[model samples]
Target: SQDQTWNDGGDFDGTNTFICEWDYEDALSASVKEFGGHSYYVFSGDCYTWEEAKRFCENRGGYLAVINNQKENDELYKLMLDFGYESAYFGYTDKEDESHWKWVSNDQSTYENFNKAEELGDVEPNGDTSENYAMFYYKYKNGAWNDGDFGFYTVNSGKAFICEWDYTNPTPYNLNDGNYTLHYTTNLGREHRSVDFDRTYDIDNIATERFTKNYQTDLAYILSVMASSAYTQGDLVYNLITLGFNDYSLFNYYDNPVDERYEEDSCAFSIAKKELSNNSTLVLITIRGSYGGFENGNLLNEHSDWYSNLTIWFPELVGFGSHQGFDAAKDKVFEQLKEELGGDLLKSNVKYMITGHSRGAGIANLLTKEMRDEGVSVYDIFNYNFACPDVAKRNFLRWNFKGKYDNIFNIGIAGDPVSILPGVPGDIISLGGHLIAQWGKYGNSYWFSDNWAEEYITYDTDLHASENYVRMLSNQKDIGNAKNWTQMQGKKVRNVGVDVIVKTTSAIPVLSGLNATITDTNGTPIAKINGNEIEYYTTDNIEINLNEYEDQTSISVNGKSDVIVEFSGIDDTNIEILVVSTSENQNKSETIAYFEAVP
Candidate 1:
């Protein structure tokens, strides 16, 4: 009854479909003209169908219609309303598909066209199951166009449409890597990988292997922690009284037959002296907490903390997985590690490294801290993934790797055990996260063997090993992966003293107050005058800022040629200039002609 003709068919009313036009004086004038106004000149009346209207408009060398943005859309709406027009038809309809309504101009939708939802229980559309098309309606509130459906037809029938166009083209991307190779190894015996050309085939396999290891380790650590209780500060008392466990022990691994918790006389460490007799080429002894034992035949004793022996007591939290714990058993282990690997570990000639996994990992990390604090050169410490509470230590390169779905990633959802320092993200590496599991060292011989010692720790090997594991500890170089890795600042690599020549057409072109300062190979400005020659030092191009002009301007240079001659006062002059090589050491300076200005 309220004119369904305007909803679908072409002929609606005297005001529904109409067009207007105006001639522009220039491009700027044309761009400034607004599309809607109450007294605008109507070029075509309400007489064309959706297709006919488009053809009619485009055939006249113009687009159907374009609403630039939201502001313009509102302006057009207001202008139509002022003209007493209800739902004046524009150049938008779902002729291509009943869904995906778009502008015929380019078949794209802008932010202005998308509709908002109505109030509660109000039958809305386009919710996952509904089609994806823009709609138009009169009395449109909450961004929904009625399309007259809720009032007259079914939910899918009465919808209107609009169109848009983008004049700019898409940008291109970088895609070059010819020097990449997969089998290349650095001087340190560490291998580098590549993902280019034919090597791209191997990338997927490498990615899959890395992903699987990280995923598996995260799953295991989460399960172990979830099945364990939050160990508190005084937990060591109960742990010691039960005799159930000692330092570096997992409660889950103990059986309660006897009340006394005894140390497991596990397999002694295997020590093979390469050439026992007359082999004194600086014996590099590495005294680390390997296999949880020592050379003195001392099996690691369980700690007083029950959380450290989580193999026995586990906690189940609803709507949460596991939590952080703060306790003192950790401190005792730190103290013992310091006493055992004291000066012997930090000797300059001794390539010693202290490392650990699980509780041992936490201890090894702390040892490095204590040694460094005592002014010892204990640079060879690498702690793999450890199941210990949060703590902070610095000046060490640590990396922490986290899995996307690892429950540990949601630690913030639970309660934080300790607050991370400023700029450190709460991820594994930030709070001491690293990818390699406690036992990952066993896979690579170079890791545990002494023959593979380098002056500095082999960063490539560390990176590869860590990348191959579940998560890596935070390191300074890993910027792309971890957030905290970005906070660190170090020496920046730079390329300086690049030489480029500028050709001038005239000799000493009108030097009215023309002046230039120069520098040498080290960017040090040079000052010297020899007879008829002036020696200027700079690899950076010399700039001549011409302020005023003087007729009898005199200038001379040694032999460098990349001098930059500029103009400010006058133009159209050519000069023969001699340049000398005071240019930076990285670049060569040559002599050339100069021009005043481009005529």
Candidate 2:
């Protein structure tokens, strides 16, 4: 009964057919026109005033047409001529302001298509303040825009209207459904492997959540109180305790109080154990960097110590020896850890993670290596370090032990100079100059060179700031995968509808054999390959051609080729599409894009 046809007189009947010269269906007779990837539908037998016409289109799930360009205006004129309508109301109006016209749908009218002809001779919009509606004029002006009054005679009676619907708005893929899991992996060269833990799992979930939270807390504790000019080790411990970590209990803390002048250059370590909400225990070790003072070993000491302490020891090979200022702090940390683990306070089953920024990161790196050498399983230890300098020399980096510690991930912000360390010459020299430049200028003019001084002064201080490290890590916590070495994760999945476009940039002409495979999120092909074709599962009624969709089109100006594939019934789900291409003479297939997916 709902599908019965309606006659022209607005009567629904089972037998009579509603016919129009243009396309007609159900109760509405409409004609379609496309321009700039958008489709416009002009409905017939619907003559309503400007307000009524807008409401009619809105009820049908579209707003009145907004012609914002010459292409759209030309298409609309053709649509009107085909329908044989002299004039029809569109979406623009100035009812809100006299001359400030806007589209009724969004109130934005950046492009105006108002008529500018000599024959019309200011006859267009002549009603001025009296007219508020606009219509496409097909008679006197031959497909130009004209203004009309809302209540004036025939115009007030009703007018055919055009409605616009955008089909290109991509539907977002939902991840809440339990059927799929996002898997990500990054290729770290030299047999090193990094896999993103199924975030849905318990172990990874606890590790990531706790690491992000406690790391931020420790950073804030160091910056606000420990790095302050008036900071003392007693003040540092009190402030950390007041921060209120859940189930917090400090196991040990160490700071050397004997060196009073350099005491403010506080290199301290704290180990705390906390119970996670998921009924698991987390052992957190946080190392705090120095406070800002020349006497206290801060940036100046870190730079000088790195170059001065470079050593070439056997077995371990080239390595950076501990700085004299932080040697006491480092020795104290190991001493406390050895004592605490031997006692009944620490457990073997609890998760252990080390975190720090800048100089603290340097200490944490040393602790990780020490723990590993003591026969602690690599799987049991995790390191989340920010702006960590390269502590080990070239030969030490090539060691088997360094390659096996997959759980240690050093997060460096894009422009962080400290992360790249003494390799960044500008930062090292800048630190040196900041500490001794004034002394050279007044006390010993011969100590400084003009060229070296100029270069040091030009270093980018903003890129090496501790605050930047904190900010970058904080922003990365939500999107960065905790289990992976690189910050590539599920957030890269885009909602690009059912149709996916794979673009390849190469100089080769005409990819001969193009094939695609639908895979699960983990890169396992689900479709079976028969000869050169692969079949994907879809619903019973829907029909799709896997071969026809794989045809390539040339985008020569950009030196790229594009291939499109459509996957029906895969809506609202996550899927990986693997596309491969081969040139005419090539025997081996080339993988174009891998790990490309829709969420």
Candidate 3:
């Protein structure tokens, strides 16, 4: 066909599969393609959301193919030309901050395979906030990439997808042998390795020093400041890395393009994590606030986009609901996070530390409450919402989940006007402060020092700007630090313990809890696990059998099942450790990590 109808990804994803076109064997056999020591499994049998596709690929022992260069893209695109697929989901998306696109594998892809609007008539990645994930070779050719919705809206679109498996060159943590690549075992007992982390730490001295070591008290403020960057289009990797997060999912809808919602703007948030010594992870999710500017004619309200902020109300019920706009915004961010992180995994085994500013702050507050409602253990989440507005019916949590969200910490400027916005003005009915419209927020509140030297705050009207907040936080070392400022207890509104850091290269299977045990087989006392921390000891006795460290200690970290992480080491040399985990139901094995530390 010379002409094909172009459908918008936001068109409700109304698609159906009349018949199954391919099967697992078909995808593996004839559709199997190889490049750069990796395998690609192509299938046109089903159309799935970007998140669904990613999870499917991982379950198949790979991930959505992350095309790195033009050659790789061309190779796959050429083969796909014979098919009738309208589009396919890949491993790339700008879900984190709309400004900077990244691979799901965090490959740091420098190659751009975008089509020119002049030639193809469609600008790549121009779908704005509604479409964050990337779809491959849609309307035009040349392996062009377009920012697409999670699901391909049309019938022909998203029917084909490719999975990439790198058993040889697994990213972030790789152990290359002289003539070959060493292997390890994991959850599924060694099917494939992982592709997260930035490799910022020296693999050799992870025991002695880790880049993700510093767990600071002021981290909440620093990350909330970084959250402001999502309001603008920029790279967040470096900043998050500095904050000790080796792996993160940055989702942004704050890009200042003509927005999709006339009454309710989209939002942005990031889910990041750092590996700790005790085989545990410290997870932080930061949400971005209103992308505002003084040029928009509102000096006082930096949530300057007047359209979305103009109307405010609870969606359904009046006295027992959240603000429609902010609530929907929170749902969008949370859904994307669950879809990306895998819902069950996020709900269990992992905890969260959340922070945000302004609109993002409001959303984060509601999000924290929702996370609790949706089975994300309350003890597993701690939120810090800054310059936040009310997002719920005030008594929403007071009567039901009282004291449940005590970990939430909401901070704001003393006289910031936005805090009271949509105030008693937006709605004509003017219900009590406990009812709705920026009234219900779930957390403790505090005011920053009011006597900030005027130099820190650039404009009296726009003190809610992310930079200004950063400045105030800079003056006050602690986010909880507040002084002489009078509390405007007006109409009220609204909003994790990591035992050990175990870096796993493979996807951890679904489990109730991680049960850890150290056996006295080889060298049980070499590395000791404390409360959420690991302490290592050195034996100067050269007579001690260094060979004993190879299979010395065994670990079992799942409460209901047997998920094992075995550790081994060398004496003042490259550490050779093999990690394994076996799945009980699947009866399969996979290698989560294979470490060869070069001294």
Candidate 4:
């Protein structure tokens, strides 16, 4: 029996019941080391032959590094030198023919470096049969490659090698056109929510859970996508479609997305609406935050955003003067949102929700505060925030919300610095650059750690990245409940993760499943359509034909943790399977990620 431990990534008290959620990939590349579209590593002192090192790299989800140009070659050389290695192996090798060179990662016969001198003549690969491997001799400068026995070591040598890997973000997805595209907003690249947090609490009856859980992830993923400029209003609408909402449209509502600085819409906002089956309305108002990381949006519009984030004032005297930077931003957001959301919020049949991340998260929190001050109760609005900065002075906000902050879902990640910026963590009032130095946030606080890879892919910035929050939320959506709103507080809200999926090592693109059903050969009902082209059902111990459909080539499965999958007639590497186990019992539902490598 094989037992695999899955980290729920909630809290880490370091007991046997809870372990840190990280992987070898995290250990291998959980670094600040990244460059040129790949992760870099300098293996030192692990003396191994060329073949052994090659296998080592492959075993760890990487390859012996390939230096494409002199500049990159110098960079790697410097790194190895910094590690105090006298000699190191690169990807180029000629051991097979003793003359023909090739890159170890790919069998391309391209030779770029060969040691040459003014007098020593043909300094490399001259060892013929004895020296068939190409490596760098740190002693020789001016771009030189030497072919020598990889086992040969000097006192100063660590026998190091450069290893590299590609990040799996923006992974592949299935296209209806029979081609392949990357994981975009259209394809979502997620297991359609494995847990449900869409349970709503009555605003009038505040004795129970106040905030909905699922929206923490929903808004995290959505706000992260909105952080990217690659997406547009169309993408947001498409996201709503994937979330199982219908008849979606972007409602700008006569606002210019006005901000305090450059004309660049720093406080850009939009509203989306869907009609519920009970004649109720569902509204999602999204506020765009500065894309401070690799995201294109914050970089393009950062000047205005930075100017605003640093305002850093907190005085109740300046018209609800709480954390003036965020308060000012909220005012600007309201200028754009007032026309769309300012009117009567008392239509009990309409579910009004406002969400944002980063600066936008602050705006959402403050906007909810202002609305309450304007006579709208917690019963009237659902506000969700993520990667939120300290919004207001602790006492002021704690008092402002009238001890009722459950309608405001304020989410923070464990390693995310932005969420705790402008002050220290958990400190009620901290100093900032303003007159009234007080900083804190108000809302029902929830925290999560990045579940994708256990460590940082970049620097501290990775902790604050929007994508990590989405991936983390994608893993465990029910850590807490932040759900969608409905007309009546008692109305049952549709939960997320109604659909489940099975994942593989991605030999093919991603395959997934919906909550559909059919009968198998056992006269029992097999359920769910897992992916775009191919589909499968959930049950114990099942076998199915992989090539039943000619045009439909994708594969999807719905299964339990102990389910076994056997495939026949579908041996190509391009096929993907999505499996889902939608047992009615919530506790019995486990995340099934079974992967098989195509040999």
* CA lDDT of each prediction against the hidden true structure: 0.27, 0.42, 0.50, 0.49
- Reference-based lDDT, residue 246, model 2: 25
Candidate 2 lDDT by residue in tens digits, 1-599: 48897545655776876556522122122335656776667754332246645654554446788877777777787787677766777898988888878898684547676677766655566567777888876444466777775324334233667877664331111123322121111111211111111224233244545443223333332232222211223222332332222232332222222224333223546665555565656566767543332221112333232222221122122223333333344555667766656643235566666756556665666676566666665656666555565444333333334355445545544333345442222222211212111110000000111222121222122444444443433333432223221221111211111222322232321122333444444554444323234464533222222211112221110111232433343332233444433222221123445443453
User: Taking the tens digit of each residue's C-alpha lDDT, what string does model 1 give over 33-116?
Assistant: 244331111122311124433432332234445554676567655544544444444554454565445666663546445444
Candidate order (lDDT): 3, 4, 2, 1
Model 3: runs farther than 4 Å from truth?
1-217, 244-246, 252-256, 259-265, 292-306, 315-317, 345-349, 396-402, 422-438, 452-459, 477-486, 489-599
lDDT of 3 by residue, 365-428 (tens): 8888888777776566767777777665546447225666766766777546455443212221
Best candidate according to lDDT = 3
**Could you estimate the TM-score for every candidate?**
0.20, 0.32, 0.42, 0.39
Better of 3 and 4 by lDDT: 3
Model 3, position 106, has a per-residue lDDT of 80
Indicate the residue-level lDDT of 168 in model 1: 20
RMSD of each: 30.2, 30.0, 27.1, 26.1
Superposed model 1: Cα runs more than 4 Å off: 1-305, 308-343, 378-389, 392-479, 485-599
RMSD of 1: 30.2
Error in Å for residue 171 of model 2: 46
